[model samples]
Target: MGGGPDKEHVLITLFDPEPKDITGELRRRFPHFEVTYVQVSPSRKDAEKAGNEISDDLWKSATILITLFTLPAKPELVPK
Candidate 1:
């Protein structure tokens, strides 16, 4: 799929493979936006490590990041 300015790149990291109906809700709310999912380990350390390991480009392009873990907003992930 081609992504343009109008496209919404949502990045969601969750411990469970199954989305708790959030995917449906997002799709329903923003029908035009493209949603993406990233599964991370339930362990806090593992999840944080995984998130930190993501390439800068990917993080920069994401429109919104939703994490199920307790990690605070990462400055690196959120572009200034």
Candidate 2:
């Protein structure tokens, strides 16, 4: 594999339709990023519930978030 960033990034993706193509490309470009994908229904309830189930450490460590409409159960779950 080709080299990438000096420091790894924590990237999280929440997409109703899923992001298989983009995730593959992202991994190719930035192999060092720790990427996690959680597929959820378009409904807000499902998205929020899925968000709540994720570990606090993951939410706290996330440096990038790619979300269509999903969000953490609480605003504070996101890192500052």
Local distance difference test, each candidate: 0.69, 0.65
lDDT of 2 by residue, 9-73 (tens): 44455555557798788888977776677676667667777777777776766667777676777
RMSD of 2: 4.8
Worst 10 residues of 1 by lDDT: 71-80
Query: Candidate 1's residue-wise lDDT over 1-80, tens digit each?
Result: 22465676777777889585989888889887767777778897686687776667667667777777723347755552
Which RMSD values do the candidates have, in order?
4.6, 4.8
Indicate the residue-level lDDT of 44 in model 2: 66
Error of 2 at 30 (Å): 1.2
Candidate No. with top lDDT: 1
Best by TM-score: 2
* Alpha-carbon lDDT of model 1: 0.69
Clash counts for all predictions: 0, 0
